[model samples]
Every structure is written in structure tokens, then in C-alpha cells.
Target: MELYRKTLTSATWWSLVIFNLLTFSSCKNQPESTVPSWKIKLIANSTSHVTYLVDLERAIDHILRVQLVQVPVFKGKELIVLQNIMALLDNFNPLYKYKKGKANIKNINRFIKSQTEVSQEYFKGLANDDEFATENYIGDDYIGCLGSQSGLRGFNCSLWNLFHYWTVQSSFSPELFQPGAVLWTLHGYVHHFMNCSECYLNFWFYVQEHQIEDVKTHDEEILWLWRAHNYFNRKLAGDVTEDPWFPKKQFPEDKYCRKCRWKGKWQNDKVLKYLKNIYSSISEVVGLINKEEEP
Candidate 1:
């Protein structure tokens, strides 16, 4: 009887140890929690109107100075797409107040149009051209697109901001271009020039999956881009590349625009109004530019 009792006690002890080991192993193998440590909210100054424009200008400079020259191939449809992008920027870009900067945009467009095939060196020379002198006129630093980490969100974020800005500005000036021209141009740019293979594929698939060609009306185009941007935000949330300080969530969170949502549904008219106010409204633009230019 004594021997049996001792055996039973030992069995119980071993079982308990094994159960705990299994439980711990199971917990260890489980996926890491998606909940971030930092409280997520829109960082207020990150999205200021003038900062958006300034960042857009910086992004444009990056494109002219760096991104364009890196294009691996400059033939066939690629050349036409590049020319079209430059022409679109020359014609529709609203932020170019300085004469030399506007001249640079025009000169680049003309250069691409004149070239049957452009080497990377040719592009480099065009970017470095003394006649254009882009650095003298446009922003050379990023204000709104600065990420917490060294390379988290500078160029990619700036491009999206510029895309949204162009879409809104297009809505405000429909006669200057087609309703979907800005997005179409964006698609071509991403399809050809966006260096990240994964990012380019994601954008290409999204454009195809969502019927980007069918976006017809100006209002629809504005909202389409808004929705598209939010789609990317949702996709990239919690990604390793995400900036913790600027956590990706739906844009125009209630903190930014109270009327943008009600009962968890997007009030798109109010959202449109908000976008226009930030991107295209003259009074707001004047105020922001004044504040931005302040010494």
C-alpha cells in the first residue's frame, strides 16, 4: 500500500510537469500579438495642409533628382509613360510658384519627349541641368513625410500625399484634364518606375482588381483615390515597415474630421469637402503657405 501511494504521487507530479511544459510550448509557438504598445492616433502636425504641399514638392524633387534617373529601362511603353508623367506634372502641378521650378518641370517634359531612348546618364544630366535649377525653387527637405525611423515613410508617403493632392486639384479644375487622368498617370508611374517589386505588384493588382479605368466622374475620382489610399493603409498596418509614431489607420480619423464618419460608415460628401479644404481651398492654401513661409 505504501509503495502504491508513492508511485501515484510521483505519477501526479510528472503529469503536472509535462502538462505545464506542453502549455508553455504551445504559448511559445503561438503568433505574436498584433496589438502595438504605443497609443495609435493621428499625429496632428503630420498632416497640416502646407506640410502636405511641402512634402509633395520634396517628393517631386526626389522624383526628378533620384527616382527618374534610376529607371532600369527607358524604351517602348516606358518612355511614353515617363513623358506623359512629366507633361502631366508640368500642366497640372499647382505647387510650382517659383519660375525656375516650373521651368525645370517643363524642361524635363521636353527632354523626355525629345528622346527616342534615354540612358540613365542622360536622365542624370537632365536632372543636373543648370537651366532648370530645381533646388533653388522647390522644397529640398521633407516636413510632413518624415518618419520616426531613418527610411520608414519619406518617398512612398510623399507620393501618396501628392497623388491625393493631384486628385483633389483635378476635381477643382476638371477642364485641365480628364477625371481619371491623375490616377491613370500614377498607375503608369508605379507600374514602370516604382522600384519595390512587391509594392508595384500590389498596386498593379489593386488597380486591376478595383477597376481603376472605370473611375469616371471627378467626385468619384477623388473618392476613389481616398478609398484606394485607405485600402493600402489597411493592408500595410502593423507591417514591419510601418512607422510606430504614425500608425496607419483610416485617414480623416474623427480627430481630423468629425463629419467624415458617422455610425462607422464613411460620410463621403463630408470627406470630399474635407479633402478639398485641405488640398484645394484657396483660403486654407493661403493661410498654410503663409505659415510655411514664416521666418
Candidate 2:
């Protein structure tokens, strides 16, 4: 009986030791799953309104690519032109004025000149034996030029007409080209099209008018915009709700539901318009190009 009891105790001790060893070994060997984190930072300063989207601790790498590498390669002169326009616009801001530092207007002009040269060279290479005019210049001829034929001309003309009617012969000036004004103008264009399904359908037709090759299919673009629209909506709304850091209280004036009403309305309107126009244009151009190829 003594021997049996001793044997039973020995077995129990050995079992407990083995169990503990197994548990420790399992825990030590277990792999950890990493979750990806995305961070979007909006930097609105005197000279630039920069929006940076990146993973945490990876901002420097992303910024280097965006500001130094990708912008030069992908956009080149177009980026410089945009930067110049943004800088000019930034100077007019009452809150923050752009200051010309080491890179003055001359530097900007030089950059623009360089970009134009690069663009011309690029076009020349593409033209090859064919005449330059024969090649499809959707963006270059139709969109880039300031002439009446340009789409931007049409957009600006429509905006000016609307603004003039509303304001009763308000003198048109560059001062009117504020970000808020631009946003409203874009909103109006979107609202106008969306209200008319036929016009909206026609808007896609107009995009097809551009006839860009290498453009995304209409269905694919629509799907992408739909996804993006939903994502932004969810992200912003979630930020408003889930983030304990954001203020929840109403202000003293609290006019327009403490600005939340305005925000929600504008956000939805702007996002929808942006998505619609981009998708419509891309789809239209691709469809047009494909149709032309078929015959």
C-alpha cells in the first residue's frame, strides 16, 4: 500500500511538471499576428495645404517618395504648376499669407519653363513619325489650354455665369478664386448633373468625349469611387463618434446645429460630386476609346 501510494504521488508530480513544460513551450513558440495601422494627417499651412496618408513611423519614407521622388517622376511640370497656383492662392488667405523665401517667383518661373520643355519633349517623342496633332491629346489640348475649347474654360464660364447671376454683376476677379468658392462651384456643378439623370448620364458621355487610352473602365472606376466614398464617410463619422479626443459639446451660438449640419451637408455633397465627376470622366473616356477601337 505504501509503495502504491508513493508510486501514485510520483506519477502526479511528473504529470504536473510535463503539463507546465508543455504550456511554457507552446507559449514561447506561439507567433504573433500584426495589425496594420493607417494614419492620415492634414497639414494646412501658409504656403501649402498638404494631406499626408501613411502608416505610423513610416511617414518619413512616404513623404520622401511623395515630395521628392514620385512627384518628380509621375507629375513633373504639372506638379510644379499646381504648386505655383497653390502658392499664389495661399498668399491671399487672411489667416496665413505665403512668404517668398529662397525660392522666389523667378525660381517658380524657371521650374515652370523646365516643365514646359519636358512636356514638349515628351510629346515630341510620342508623336514620332505621326504628326503631333494626329495623336489624341485629351488632357493636353482639351484640358490644359485656357482657350474656349478647354473643359476648364467651360467649367469656369459656367461658374462665373452662376456667380454673376447670384451676386448681381459682381466684378470677376482672381480674389473670387478662394478654396471655399471653388468647393461651392464644384458642388453646384455636381448638384446640377445629379438632379438630371440624363444630364448625369450625358456627363459620362462628355467624359467619353475625352477619349483617353490606358484609363480605367467605367465599371471599375465606379466601384472604386463607391468604395472610397463609403470609406471616407465611415472614417470621418467614426472619428466624430469614437474618438474621445474630439469635442462633443455645442458652442454658444450653436448656429446650424453647432456647425455639424453644415459639415455633414457639405461633406456629403462634396464627396459625392468629386466621386461622380472623376468616375464619370474616366468611364466616359475609356468607353469612348474602346468604342472607337471596335469599329
Candidate 3:
């Protein structure tokens, strides 16, 4: 009877998971791809509508594709790459904290710790599996685009959202108040999961070239990533993989922050303030900031 009860509970849990995924995929502006839109929101923002981190939600193949751009960077380096991969998944990305619905687990920090271990075990297993390969990965061509299709933003769009959200929470929470945590986490995630050789090397070189780890404060952390992202955007300005609708440019462009620029240079202080509000832990724009700054 106990075994039967456990089986029934497992079935029920997965049913809810699928139902929730379907509901989110049905969202109005979902990109034209197999992955659902709510999944997009789920990965993008933890403070988003769905409470828990859908950590094991996407299939392993899909998750790896999102970070496959890191593969080439790890090409020649074996031991160091393995160590960093472990650190990234185990320490930095505590991503699977939403394992609930059956029991009322009060200790969230404890729950997060347990769930994170399970996720890291799974991540390592997927990375080592010999069967997975770039040719068969569900990536750019797999999630094909048809000229500005919203549903086809793929991993790049999802990654951008995740990084922005990271900045917001890392700045606000005392427990997670580390300055350059996200940058290191991102690098570690790429080294282990991504398979895209060229993109992998470029990002590795780019961040290393810019010394992303040197950021000492939360404000610099946020702005540093924003700057790096803009530089990458300029590189991919006319690339075939870019989404047509979401044209790449210097983020928080001049139109959004006229005061953020002087001549051709960005005013980092003003830009930091503007970004803080947009990516705050809560939806501060509507409830906190005045209308004059909503743009």
C-alpha cells in the first residue's frame, strides 16, 4: 500500500507540472518554438508568477543547448574546466528550490540545499553522457525562426532575461549579496553545458578580456554585465541568429535614457540607477517608481 501511494503521488506531481507548463506555453507572446513561454518567464525571473524554480523542468538536451555556447572554450582545458563546472552548478546556481506541493516544507533554505544537490548530480550526469552531441542538440536551427517570430527567441533571449534577473536579486538580498557572483556563475555554466564552439570561445575570451571577475560592488557588477552584453550585441548586430523584432543595440538605449549618454559615452552612474529599478526583486515600476520614469 505504501508503494502504491508513492506511485500515485509521483504521478499526481508530474501531472501538475505538465498542466502548469501547458498553461504558461499558452501565454500570448510565446516564441514560436517547442519550449513554452511560461518556461521562459520561469527561467528568466524567480520572483516571476510561478513561485518555484522549474529546475528539472526542461529536458536535459534543451537545458544544455541554452548553454552550449561554452563548449569551445573548454576544448583544450580538461581538469580546470571540470572543476569550474562542478563549482558553478553546485555553488552558484541553486536553481531547483521549488520542489513542493505534497508537503508543507517550512525550511526554504534547507529545501533549496537538498534540491540543489539533486540538480547538480543530474547536471553532471548529462554533461558526461557520451550520446549527447552538437549535431543532435536542440539549438538555433532546431528552434528555427521565421523573420522576427516572437516564439523563436531561443536560448539567447532566455539567457539575457536570466542575467538581468540575477542582477536584480543579487543587489537586493543580503544573503545573496555577492558582487560578481553572477559573472562567475555564468562562466561556469557555459564551460560545462554549452556545445557551440565559436560562441563558447568568444564569450570566454570576451569576459576574460574584460576582467569580469574584478567587479567589487553590486552597482559595478550590474553595469559591468550590461556593458559586456552591449559589446556582444554590437558583435551580433547583423548575425543570422538574431531575432528580428528584438533588434540588438546598446541596452537602455539613448531613447530610454537620454541622460545616460554624453557625446558618445555612457554615464554609468545614471545607467545603473535606471537598471536597478527595471530589474528590482519586486515589480517596482508600477508600484514603486513614478510614471515619469516608466519608460
Candidate 4:
């Protein structure tokens, strides 16, 4: 009986592999030939969404408190890359709107920017800053990127949403950023600061495969991320770490945005419009900001 069970398990795993390969081959009509050149066995889905400002803020807090400070070696090019990331967040993170929050982030960014060298102390100190410690911005709650199961999704998921949020925010005010600035800075962060080694390798591979550096326009930057996100969705569909309640599906399912697709083919223009609408504003947080910003 033990031998039979082992054989059955092996067969089932192979079956899943074959099934996924067949699905990939069937997607010949996808807009981009997203045939990932390398395969890394880890869960990643760029479909992470940021519905509330708190979700993005929490993700940033996690990076500062958990990822950056824990870096085994925290100096040289790695330190500079993190500084650029903080600078981008200070300048454009939509969630950093209220005066106190804005001031806190700017101070952190400036500290890092002006430093020729930094230590884990800098990132650790950020967690204890008056505003960060007193405010509940990084509390243990999640709104947009929450997973059904505890370990299924959390920081990595919110991080993807944060990236999308940055792109959309940059689109609204292109003059505030150099072309591809946000994406390039994020690429550096993932390359140098992201704690997940496999995730970083795969992201780097995807960037190279897709020519992420070549993206130059605001609209292109937004769509580029959306496309890469969908590609990961396709790759990670039914992955073991996928939350059963949140089965990976190509984003903007017809129900969520009916015009996003037609006859099983994505309508890029409609999809772009849908993305802009959903990512451009955070209505839920506006009232909170109004209440908090009151003098």
C-alpha cells in the first residue's frame, strides 16, 4: 500500500506538469510571447492589488523594518540602491500624503540620500521614528492584498501592488519623474535589496526577457507592469502556494472589468483604461487623510 501511494503521488505530480505545459502552448495568441526562458520554482504573482493606501504603506514598512535591515551586508552599492528606492517613495508614493507621514518619509529618504555609507542602524531606526512608532500605518491589518490563508500571501504580494501603485501614480504626473525612473529604481531594489533570492533571480530574468529597461513612456511603463503581472499569473496558476480562495487568474476577469477582454482575447486599450481607473485613486483613504490632516 505504501509503494502504491508513492507511485500515485508521482503520477499526479507529472500530470500537473503536463497539464500546465499544454496550457502554455495553447496561449499562442497572447499579446506578448511571454514564454519564460527560465523556470524558477517559487510562488510569485504580480496580480497583487492595492485597494487602500494602508496596504502600500504596510508593504513599505515591511521592507524597511524586515527586509532592508536584515540584509547580511548593508553597505556599498546595495546601500545606495535602497536609498534611491526610499527617495522614489518619498517623492511619489501616493500613500505618503498627510503632512506628518510625508515629513517622516522625506526625512528618512534624505538621511539615506545624503549618506556616503549606511548601516542596519538606519533602517532599524526608521521603525522607531516618532511618526512610525506612534501611527498605526504599519499595523497588522491588510486590506487589498490579504490572502485567504495565513502564509499564502502577505509581504511579497503587497510589494507587487506597491510597484503597480508607483507606476500608476507616476503616469498621472509624468513631469515629476524621469522616464522609467520608478521601474528602474525598483529593479535595483529587487536586484540588491529583495531578501528572496529565487524571486529576485526570476524577476531579473523576466526583466531581461521583456526588455523592461526599454520602456520609456508613462503609458508604456504602466502597461509593461500589467503585462508582466499577467505573465506571472499564467505561470503561477494552480501553484502550490496559490491561495485556494484566490486562484490565480489572468487579471481583470470579465466580471471585474467586462470590457477588458473580448472573444477570449485581451483588448489592450480597454484593459489600459481599466487599470488607470482602478489604480489612479484611493477613495477609501481620502476620508482618513482628511480626518488625520486636520490641524
Evaluate model 4: give its lDDT.
Answer: 0.60
- Ten residues in sequence with the least summed lDDT for candidate 1: 1-10
Error of 1 at 119 (Å): 3.4
TM-score, each model? 0.73, 0.23, 0.51, 0.73
Candidate 1: Cα lDDT at 37: 25
Q: For model 3, what is the C-alpha lDDT against the true structure?
A: 0.43
Any runs in candidate 1 off by more than 4 Å, and if so which?
A: 1-51, 130-138, 199-209, 281-295
What TM-score would you give candidate 1 relative to the actual structure?
0.73
- Model 2's TM-score against the true structure: 0.23
Alpha-carbon deviation at 53 in model 1, angstroms: 3.0
CA lDDT, every model vs. true structure: 0.62, 0.25, 0.43, 0.60
What is the per-residue lDDT of model 4 for residues 1-295, given as tens digits with 9 covering 90 to 100?
0100011122223223223221322222223222221111111232433366766766777777766877755567676667667776787765455556777777788787777777676667775666675553634455555555454455656777777778887788777775566656565565455432122233445545566447778788888878877777787787665655567788887667877888999998898888887777663442222233359
Which sequence of candidate numbers ranks them by lDDT, best first? 1, 4, 3, 2
- Could you tally the backbone clashes for each prediction? 0, 2, 9, 0
Give the CA lDDT, 0 to 100, for residue 49 in model 3: 25
Cα lDDT, model 4, residue 205: 50
Per-residue alpha-carbon lDDT of candidate 1 for residues 1-295, written as tens digits (9 for 90 to 100)? 0100011122223223212211211212223334222212223243443335567776677777776878766877678667767766877665466666666777777778788898878888877676654443444555556555455566777777777777887777777777677766665565456532222334445555556557778888888878877876787677666666777889888777888899999998999999878776422121123343359
Summarize candidate 2's per-residue lDDT along 1-295 as a digit string, tens digits.
0100011122222223212211211212223222111111111111221111111102212122222232223144344333333233233211111132223333433454445333434322422324322221222211110121111122222222222222211112323332223222222223321122221231333233332222233323223223322333343343312222212222111232232236444333443334333222221121112222355
Task: Tell me, by lDDT, which candidate is best.
Answer: 1
